[model samples]
Target chain A: MRKIYFLFASLLAGNFLFSQATPPPADDNSLSMANTQGLLRTQLTLTPSWMMKGTSGNDSTSISSARTNVYLHGTLEYYWTEHFSTRGDIYYFLNKNSAPGGLKKNHSLQVGCSYHFMKGMSLDPYVGVCGGISLVQISPMDFMKGDSTFLPNYQVPSHLDPVWAPRVGMNFYGQHVFHFFVEAQYLMGTYRPAIGPILSINEIRISAGLGFNFVILHKEATVRPAI
Target chain B: MPYSYYFSKLIDPNPMKKILVFAFLLVGISAFAQDRKPNKNVGGQFSLGVRSTISLFSDAGSSMGTGAGGQFRIRLYNFMNTEWFGDYLMSSIGTIGTRTDYHIGWSVMFYSPKQKPFKKYHPKPYFLTGHCFDYTRIAGNNPFYQDPNHSVASRWSSAVQAGLGFHIPFCERVDLSLSAQYMFHLGKDITAVTRTAVNGDEFLYIDKEEASINGHLLISFSLNIRCADLWHDHQKKGGARKAAPDPDGQNPKHIEQ
Candidate 1:
C-alpha cells in the first residue's frame, strides 16, 4: 500500500510539473493543455438527445421496457491536442420509465479521449470511446410476482452496471468562445437484469448542443507587486 | 499589546474550542486592516460555489456515492476563510440496496502562502477542518440485514472532517477546487446493504454486529464564483496608513490580487 501511494504521488507530481512546463499555445487553433485566452480548450456542451430506444416491457430484459425518450445530455471536453483530448460527461433521462410499476430512471458517467480530424478547418469532426458506470433505479416491487421476502418494504432498488459508448461527432467553431456540435453514439450494456436469456440492454444516442470553452493562463509563481 | 499574546490566549483547553477562538481572532484582526487587495482574491469577501462530493463509506471499501452541494465561503484574511455547505447523495451498498445521505457542514480553510510546496508548481493549497450534521436513510428494508423488530428509519449524527486541497483560479469570476477530506460520522452504524449468495438460494450468513462509527473519505470538486474584495482601493488612498510605512514591507512575499 505504501509503495502504491508513493507511485500515485509521484505520478501526480510529475503531471503537475508537466502542466507547468508546457506553456499555453499562442495560436487559438492548435490545442494546448493549459486554459488561456482564445485557447478556451475546455468545452461544456448541453444537448437534448432523442433516444432510439427506452424502457419497454420484455425488451431483452424482464425489468426493462422499450420506448423512446428525449433527454438532456451534457458533456465537458478538454482538448490536449489539436486532434486529441480527454472528456468526462454525465447524462440522465428526463422522464422516468414506468414499465414495472416503478420509475425507471437512468443516468451515467463516462471518461474517454477524443480524436479530432482536420485540424485547421472551421468544422472539426471527431470520434471517441469511453467506459463508465450506468445506474438504473426501479422500485415499488409489489408488482414483482415473487415472494415478498427479498424486499419487505416495496422500495426502490438500484443497479449499477458497467457501461461503454463509442461516439462520432462534428464541431462547428464560430467567431467567439461558443460553438455548436452534433454527436451520435451507441452505448453498450445496462445493469438492468434480464428475465429469461440475454444479459442486459444497450442504447444508441444522438445529440446536438452548444458549448463554451475558456482558456486561463497559469499565474506566474511570483506574487503581483503592489502598484 | 503584542499580537503574539493574543495568539497565546486563543490556544484554549479544548482543541475544538481553540480552533473556534483562533478563527474569530483572525477574522476580527483582518476586518479593520486595509492592506490586502480590494477585490481580486478570496480575501475579506464572499464567494459562492457548487460542490460535488464523492463519499466512500468505510463499510463498502470500494463503493462510493456522489453528492451535489453548494457552499458559501467568506475569506477573513489572507490565510483564513470560513465555508458553509450542504450536500445530498445516494449510494448502493452491496445487495442491501440504496442508502441516501444529506449532510450540512461548515469548514475553516487556512491558505498556504504564495511559495510553491514540494517544488511542484500548482494552485494554492489550503488545510481545512470542520463539523457537519449528517442525516442518512436507507432506501429500503434489507430483508437480510435490517433489524427485524426495528422500523426501517433514518439516522442523524454529528461528524467532523479534515483535509487538504487546492484552489485553482480558472478566470476572474471562476475558480476550480479539488479536495479530499476524511469524515467520521459518529452515529449508529446501520447495515448499509447485504451480500447475496451466487445461487440466490440462501441469505449469506455472516457476523451481524452493532456498529456505532461510520467513516467516509470524501473527494470533492467545486467551481466557485468568487466575489470582489470587501475593501475598496480608496480606503488606502486616504494616505494615513502610508505615513506609518510598514517597517519590513520592502518586497511583499505574498502578492494576492
Candidate 2:
C-alpha cells in the first residue's frame, strides 16, 4: 500500500513538472483566414462499431470455445480548423454474453482529441487516445455449476477498473452520404487483478464498425442575390 | 458467604432494580464522606471498549438465511473495578435490482464487573444490551434471470441480537476483551419483489432475508473514571486524626475510615 501511494505521488509530481515546463504553441496565422472564407465547416458524426473480445491466459480451464460478444460504439466529432478536429467516443456493451459461471458486460465513456490528415477526400485517417473506466462482472455460478457432458465453465470476479486504449483508424465516405470504417484498439492495463480462476488473462480487443452522416443544415449554396 | 447471600437476594429476579439500588448507595456514601472532609487526593483511571459483530451474506443467485451482528467491551471502572461486556445482533438481507444487496439489524448486551484493589492485575466481566442499525451493499450482475423482482423491501430488512462479552484490564484504564453472540430474526417470513422469468413457466422473487450465519471479530479501546476521588478529602482528615492519638489510642470508626 505504501509503495502504491509513493508511486502515485511521484507520477502526479512528474505531470506537474512537465506541464509547468511546456508552453502553448504560437497561434496559427491561417486560422483567421479560414474562418473568414467559411471553408472551415464543422462536421458531426455517429459511428456504431462492432467489437469481438477473446479470453486468453487460463483458457483451457474454462469453456472450449470462447463466445463471441457484440457491443455498440458511438462517436461524436467537431471539425476545429479543417484537418484538425476533436472527437469523443462512447462504448456500451450490455449483457453481451453470459455463461454458466458469470456474465460479462462493458460500458466505457471516453473523450479525446483526434487529428485528421486528409481533407476534401472520401477517406479520412485519424489517430487518438482515450482513458475511462470499465465495469466487469464475473459470476460464480458460471464455474460452480455445469453439466458433466459440457466443458467446465471458468468464472471471474466482478470488478471496476480504469481503462486506457489508444486507437488508429480510418473513415471512408463513399458516395458522400454512406460511410464505412474500421479501427483496431489495444485494451491495456488492469487496475485490479482478474477475477475467478483465471488470474493471468488481461488485455482484450475492440474492433470494426460502420456509420453514416446526414447533413441537417448545410451552408447556403450562395449569398442571396439583389434585385 | 454472608455478603454473597445478601448480594444474591438483591439481584433475585430483579436485576434492573438491583442496579439502581447499587448506584444510589454509592452516591449516598460519597455524599456522607464529603460532609466530613474538604480536601483529599484521588487518582484517575481509564477503560477499553469493544463490540461483537455479525454480517448477513448474499449473492445475486441464491436465497440464504438471516444474518447476525454484535459488539464486545473490556473497560476499567476505577482503581479497583474492571468490566467485560458482549452483545448479540441480528439483521435482514435484501437485493436491489439485479446487482446490489442491503442488510440491517440491532443487538442486546450483558456484562460483569470485577474489583481487586490489592492485586497488580484484575479480571472483570461485563454485559451490555442495546440496539444498532447496519447496512451493506454487494455489487454484481444477475444473468440467470433469477429474482427479477428488484424492490427495496425485497432487497433488505432488519434483525435483533443478544450476546456475552469477556474483558480483562492490563493498565490503570486500558483493557482487552472478546465476545461471542447469536442474533435471532423477529420476522421469519421473507419479503421480495416478483417478476416473470424468461422461461415463462415461473415467476422469480428476490427475498429480503438471507439464509446464513452472521459472525464478526472486533477490537476496542475505552476510558474509565473511578469515583473514589469523591471521598478523598474525608480519608485525609481521618488520617490526620489518627496521627493525634487519643488517650487510649482508640477512635470511633467513621464512614471515611
Candidate 3:
C-alpha cells in the first residue's frame, strides 16, 4: 500500500510538471491560409460555457423534490462568412440530491444546434433544440435510519434512452470581453425499465454564468497604395 | 513400576476429565466477577454507534434469506448529534456448500457541535430512522426460493433503531465507545421463501419465515474525535480540583470540615 501510494504521488507530480512546461514554437510560413482560417475562424470563435443549475422534479411517487445540477455547455459557432453562421451546442448535465436515507446522482450528455437571430450582436438571442441519452443512478439504503445510510447505498441499473429537450436563451456580451447569459431547458423522457412498468421522467433547468473569449489570431490590416 | 501405572490410569480417566472441566468453570466465573469492577473516571458517555446485521433470521425454515442492514446514532439533543450508518444487504447462496451473501451499500454521518459535554463523559441515547432502497438478489438450491422468475427485489424500505451507548475518553479530544442496539424493520415481512421439488417433475413454492419477530439485535463500536469544542475554556476557568469546602455544616461535612 505504501509503495502504491508513493507511485501515484510521483505520477501526479510528473503530470503536473509536464503540463507546466511550454512547447517550442512551430514554423509560421509552412502553415496554409485555409488551415489558418479553419483554426482561427471556427476554433477561436467556439467558446465553452459552464453553468450551475437548480432543478425540481417529481419522482414515480409524485413527490416534489429539488436537486442541485451543474452542467457544462459548449457551443461552437461557425461563420461561412461574417453574416451566415451555424452554431452547434453540446451540454453535459450532472444532478445530485442528498435525501433523508440515500442519494441519487444522474449524468446526461446532449448535443444540439441553433440559429442566431441577429449576426455579430453583443447580445445574441438564439433558439435551439437538443436530444441525447441520460444515465440515471438511484441509491437506496436497506435497514438503516437517517442520512448516514445515504452514502453506502447500492447503485441501481442505469437507465439508457434518448432524452429530447428544447432550450431558449440569449448570450449577453459585455465590453466585448465577458459574456453572461441565462437559459432555460426542459427534458422529457421515459425510463424504460428492464422489468416492470415504464416510468416517465421530466426535468426543467435554468442556468446563467459568465465566460471570456480569447483572441488567438487578429486580422491583419490592409494598406492601399497611393494611386 | 506399580506407582507409575496407577498414576497414569488416574490421569487418563475419562469421567475424571469431565469433573475437572466442571471444576475449572466454577473457578473461572468466580474469578471473573471479582475482577469485574465498575469503571470509574473511565467516563464512557456521549457516544453513537451503528451496526448492520450481516445475517438475518426469518420465521419460515425455507431458507430464502435477505442480507443484514442497519444504522447508528448518538444524539445529546435534538439538534446536536453524531451518526454512523451502513447499506442494505443483497443475499446469495454459495456454490460449494455454505450459505453466502453480498451487500453493496454506502454510509456517511456527521455531528453538530452543540450536544456534547464540556469536561465529563456524557452518554446519550439516540433514535435512528431512515429509508433503505434494497436490491436484494437471492440464489440458492434451497427448496424455499421466493420467485424464480425474479430473484431480485428492487424496493424502498424504512428502518428504526433504538440503543444506549457510552464513550470512554481516549485523549483530551478523542473518545471511543461500544453500544448495543435493537433494530426493527418498520414495514414489509422479514421472511425467506424457496421452491421445493414436488414429485420430481413439479415444483411447489414454500415461504419460510425465520425469526419473524419485529426486530433484531445489533452491537457496534465507534470512535469519535472532537471537531469543535465550545465550553472547554469555561470548565478550565474553575480549578481542576473540587471547590474548597464551606465552614458551615449546611454544606456537606466532608468538604465543610
Candidate 4:
C-alpha cells in the first residue's frame, strides 16, 4: 500500500511539472496589441423597416400613413485601418401588398465608409454616410368611376432613384468569432415616374443582428498592452 | 478562423439560405489575388468575366429590365482596349405585356490620360463607344387576343452606344467596373401606349411608333479577372521590379528585429 501511494504522488508531480513548461495554446479571443488591418466582416439579417411620414411626397401629412416593409439585408464590410472601414449593404424587398396600388418593391444598394470610435475594445461605435440607388415601384391604384364600378388596372412604371443615407451603429464582439451589431439609417431619395406625382423615398430603418469576423491579413503583435 | 456560433444558428434551419451563405462565403474566400506591380512598359493584357446590367428609360413603357451577360477584354496598349460582349434582356411592359431583347456588341475603350497606370486601388476612368446587333420582341400577356397580329411584334435592328466608366481594381488580377451608356436603336419603333375606353377602362395598345429611332439607358456592373498576357513586353517586366519600392524602406534581407 505504501509503495502504490508513493507511485501515484510521483506521477502527479511529474504531470504538473510538465504542464508548466508547455505554453497554453493561443486563444483567438484573447485580447492583443495587434492592429486590426485587413479584417473582413459579413452579416445578413431580416429587418422590418418602417417608411416615415410624408413618403408619398404629396399633401398628406399623417405620420402613420405608410406601411411597414420587411427586407432581407446583407452587408459586407472591410477594415482598411483600425478606425476606418468600408461597407456595402443590399436590401431586398420581401412583401406583397394587398392594395392594388401600393408599394410593389423597394430595393436598395449602398456603399460607404465608417469611422469607428473604439480602437481595440470588443465594443465599437461608428457613424457613416452612404450613397446608392433605390429601385422602387408602385402598383396602379383602382380608378372608381361610380360607387361600385371598378376600372381596369393602370400600369405605373418602376424607377431607379439615387439615394443617400446617414448611419450610426454599434458592434459588440463576442469571445471569439461572433459579433452583434445594431444600426439605424435615415435614407433620403425621390422617385420620378414617367407619369404621376414624384414620390419621396425617405425613411428610417433599424436593424440588429449577428455577424462574423475574419482576419484576412494578420499583423505582428509588437505593441505593449496598456495594462 | 473559427466558425461563429451565430453563423451556424442562422444557417441551420433553411437549406436555401445555407446555399446562399455558402455562395457568398466562396466569394469571400476567393478574394485573395496576386500582387501585380504597376507596369509602365507593358501595353497589352487580357481579361475575361461576367457582368450584370439594368436597362432603364426605354420607349416601350416604364418597366425596367435586368440582364446578365459576359465580356472579354483585349488590351492593345496601356491606354487602349477592346471588349466583346453578349447580353439577353427581358422586361415587362405595363401590366400584361413583355419585351425581350438580345444584343451582341463590341466596344473600344480608351483609358483616360489622368489615370495612374496599374494602380490597383485607385479608380481609373475610361470612355467607350460600341455598336451592337439586336433582336427585340414585344408580346401581349393575353394569348387569345382578338387580333393575333397585334398581340406580338418583333424587329431586328442595330444600335450604337457611348459611355463613360470607371474601373476599380482590387488586386493585380481582379477588378470591378461600372458604366452608364446611352444606346440609340436605329429601327422601327415598337411602342406601347395606354388608352382609356368610354367605359372608363384603361388598356395598353402595342403598335409601331411613327418615329424610327429608339433610345434608352444601359447601366452595367462587371467583375473581371486578368487571365493572360497576349504579348510579352520586355520593358514592362523590367519596369515592374523597379517600380515597387520597399514599403518599409529597408532591405528585406537585412531587416533587424
Candidate 5:
C-alpha cells in the first residue's frame, strides 16, 4: 500500500513539473480554426474516484460510492478531420474492494470513440461509449476449512469481467498547453460466480484531470493559425 | 464496512438502472452533437477513444448487461473511414451467476457531410457493416447447499452486425456518436442449473448444447479523438529530417546516434 501511494505521488509530481516547465501553446483549442482539425492530444489524467454499489443481487452489497479510490487514465487520440475519431484507453483503479477475498484491485483495457458536439472557444462538451475487460483480484473466498472457528468465509477468488463505461463531459483549453476537464462515467461490471449469493457491481465515476494537447506536423506547418 | 460484507452486495438486483443511464447518455450525446452546425472540415486524422455499451438481451436469460469496448479508426476519404472495434459485457442471472460476452469486428463508416461552410455544429450521418467473433460463458457457485457441481461450459461464435448511426462533432477533433444495430451469432450455448442425481447428491450441472443461431440488439455511445495533430509540430519542424539519413534506406545512422 505504501508503494502504491508512492507511485501515485510520483505521477502527480511529474505531471505538475511538466506543466510548469512547458510554455502554454499559442494555438489552444479555442484559438485554433473552428472547422479544421486541431492538435492531436495525448492526455494523461489522474482522478480520485468515489466507488459505489447499485443494488442487491442477493443479500450481499458491494463497494459503496462513499469510498474514494485513485484512478489513473491515459488517452491517445487524433485531431478530428471528420465528425468523430477513435480512442484507446488504459486505466488503473486503485484498491477498492468490490469483490470478496480481501481488498480488490482492478486493471482495465478499453476502446471507443468521442464525438465533439458543442465546441466552445474555451469549453467543449461531448459524450462517448467505451467497452472492454477488467482484470480483477479479490480476497480469498475460503474462511476456515477446519480451523479454530467454524465460520464460513464468503469472499470469492480473483477473475475478469466484461465491462463498459458511458461517459459525458467537457474539455476546457484556453490556449494553454495544459487543459482541464471533468466528466461523469458509469462503470458496469459483469462477473458471474458459481457460489454463494453475489450481486453485480456498477459504479459512477466523476473525474477531473489535466491534459497535454499537441500535434504532429512538419516545421513549416508549425505556424499558428491566424486568429 | 468490511470488504466481505459489501463485496457480496456487488451483484445489482436492479440491472436496469445501469442500462437506463447508458441509454440516457447516448440520447443526450446525440442531441448535444446535433444541436449546432458542424465545422465540416474532414481531413486526414487517426483517433483513439473509449466506448461504453449495454446489451439489451442475453439469449440465455434475456437479461441486460454492461460492457466496455475500444475502436481504432482511419480516415480513408472525405466520405469514407474504416473502424476496428472490440468489447465485452457481463450480465447477471438471478443471485448466483453472470454471463460474459466478447465482440471484435470492423466496419466501414460511410459519411454524409452537408456542404455548409459556417455551420455551428455539423451533422454527419453514417452507415456501417462489420463481422465479429462472439464468446460467452456461464458460471455459478456450488450446485447444492453443501455439494459442488463439476461442469462449466463456454462457447465462441462468429457474428455480424450492420447498423446506422450519426456522428455529431463536439469540437475540432472530438465526436459523439450513437449507433443501433442487430447482431447474429452462430455457435453453441452454455448453461448451468442446480440438479440432484443418483443417491441425491446436489451438484451444479453445466452443459454445452448446440445453438443453431442467436441474435441481439446492440447500442453504443463513443467519444473519439483524432491523433495526427499530436505529432504535427514535431514533424513540421523537421524533427526526423534533422537526423542523419540511411544511405541504403534499410537502416538509419541516427538510430546509433
Candidate 6:
C-alpha cells in the first residue's frame, strides 16, 4: 500500500514538473485546456472504495476483511480562473455488503476548490481539500443463542457525520467536448452514534473516467476598425 | 393557394418533400425574426440558476440537512436584483424521525457598490431580504409512534429571511455565488420527542405543537447564467441600430440610410 501511494505521488510530482515546462499547443482550433477560465466539467461514474486505517467493527471479520464499498460518484467542477476551480462532489450509496457488521449505507456530498499546478498544459494536476457530511450506517451484528451479545449488541443506527477529504488528481484535456481524469481521495470521518461505540468511517476512494466540459463564455477579442 | 405552390406540389414525388421545404422556411423565418439586442435598461439582464443548500440549527433535526433547488434573477437596477426560487430539503433526526421541508420564496438583492454588466474576476457583494412559504413534514417509524394517530405530523408556514452574500463572475455570462441567511418561520411547529424505556429501548413520537415560530440558518451556493435581456435599452431604442453581422460573424456591408 505504501509503495502504491509512493508511486502515485511520484507520478503527480513528475507531471507537475513536466507541465510547467510545457506550453499550450499552437495552431489548435479545438478548445484549449490552458485557457480554462469559464469551463464547466461534469462527470458521473461508479467508484469502488475501501475502508482503510479506521476503527474496527464489532463483527467477527476484521476491518481489513470487510467487503469493498461501491458508490456512484458524480462531480461538477467549474474553472473560475486559469489556475483555480471550484468543485462539488456527490457519492451515492449503491451496493450493500453481506459481511457481518458491514456498511449498510455510506454516502457523502462535498464542495471545495482546487489549485491547478500546470495551468498552461493539457495535463492538469492539482491538490485540494473538501468538507461535507456523510450519512453512514453499519449492518447489525448477528445474535446467537446462549451468547453474551449485550456488550457489542448496541443499537447501531444511521448517523450523519461531518467528513473532510484531501485529494490529489490529474485531468487530461485532449478534446473540446470531453476529457479523462483519475483521482484519489482519503476521506476522514467518525460515526459517533447515540447508543454505540465510535466508528471511524475513513476510507480511500479512487475513480477514473471520461468527463464532459462546456465552455460557457469565450474571451473577448480585440476588434479593429473596418477600413 | 398560390399557382406556383400548387405547381411545385404537383411535381414533387413525395409529400415529405413539401414538409421538409416548410421546415426549412420556418427555420429561416425564426432565424431572421428577432431584432432585439441585449437590454441596457435597469433590471433588464435575466438569469436562470441552480443551487445547493445546507439547512442548519433547526429544532426538528440534530444534524445539518442538504437539499437542492433552482432560482432565476431579474436585475432591477445597476445595484439591485430580485430572485425567485424554490427548494426541497430532507433531514434525519438521529434514528427516530425524518423531516422534509419545501420552500418557495422570492428575494430582492442590493449590491453594495453599483455593479457593471459582465464584470469578471472580482467579488460582487450584496445584501438580500426575502419571504417564502414553507411546508414541513416529520414522521417517525419507531414502535412508540407506529400507530396511525401519532406517527406523523406536518405544517405550513410563512418565513422571512435576510442575509448577505457575494458573487464571482467567471465570465461574461456565468457567475458563482455563495450566501448565508437566517429564516424565521411563523406558524405551527412539528416537534419530535424521544423516550427511552427501562430496557434501553428508544421510541420516537412526532406531533404538531402549538402555534409558534421557529428559525434556521440556510447556506447556499449557486451558479447562474445570464440567459436573456428582457427589456429594450432605453438609450438605443430610437437611435441607429448596430449593423448586423453575417452568419460567419463578419461585419456586413454598411448601406447608407
Which candidate has the top score in TM-score? 6
Q: Top DockQ: which candidate number?
A: 5
Candidate 2 vs 6: which has more TM-score:
6
Q: Rank the candidates by TM-score, best first.
A: 6, 5, 4, 1, 3, 2
lDDT of 4 by residue, A1-227 (tens): 35545655886897698678534436654633344556777899988877765433224332223678888999998776667676789999888474766778789987666778888766789997666667888776554455653445756677666566789999876543667999999876655454434445678888899988776765343122333
Considering lDDT, where higher is better, how would the candidates rank from best to worst?
6, 4, 5, 1, 3, 2
Lowest-lDDT window of 10 residues in candidate 1 chain B? B238-247
Task: Provide the lDDT at B223 for model 2.
Answer: 22
Q: What's model 1's lDDT at B166?
A: 84
Backbone clashes for every candidate come to 15, 50, 36, 0, 103, 1
Cand. 6: chain B TM-score: 0.74
After TM-score superposition, what is the CA distance of residue B229 in candidate 2 from its true location, in Å? 68
Clashing pairs in 6: B43-B75
lDDT of 4 by residue, B151-198 (tens): 567898899999999887655665678899999999888877666557
Model 2: CA > 4 A from native:
A1-67, A142-157, A174-178, A191-210, A214-227, B1-257
- The 10 consecutive residues of candidate 6 chain A with the worst lDDT sum are A218-227
How do all models score by TM-score?
0.53, 0.30, 0.30, 0.54, 0.56, 0.61
Off by over 4 Å in 3: A1-95, A100-103, A141-154, A195-198, A214-227, B1-257
10 residues in a row with least lDDT, candidate 2 chain B? B38-47
What is the alpha-carbon lDDT for the whole of candidate 6?
Answer: 0.71
Pairs in steric clash, model 4 = none
Report the Cα lDDT for residue A130, model 6: 69
Off by over 4 Å in 1: A1-68, A72-98, A101-142, A145-171, A175-179, A183-206, A209-227, B1-42, B60-62, B114-121, B139-151, B192-211, B231-257
lDDT of each: 0.58, 0.39, 0.39, 0.68, 0.62, 0.71
CA lDDT of B240 in candidate 4? 31
Model 2 agreement with the true structure over B105-203: per-residue lDDT tens digits: 323333322222322234455454434333433221223333233332232224444455544433332333444444433332343344644544222
Write candidate 3's Cα lDDT for B130-219 as tens digits: 332232223332222325553333223344555555554433334445555555544344333443355332222323333222544445
- Shift in Å, residue A227, candidate 5: 15
* Better structure of 1 and 3 per lDDT: 1
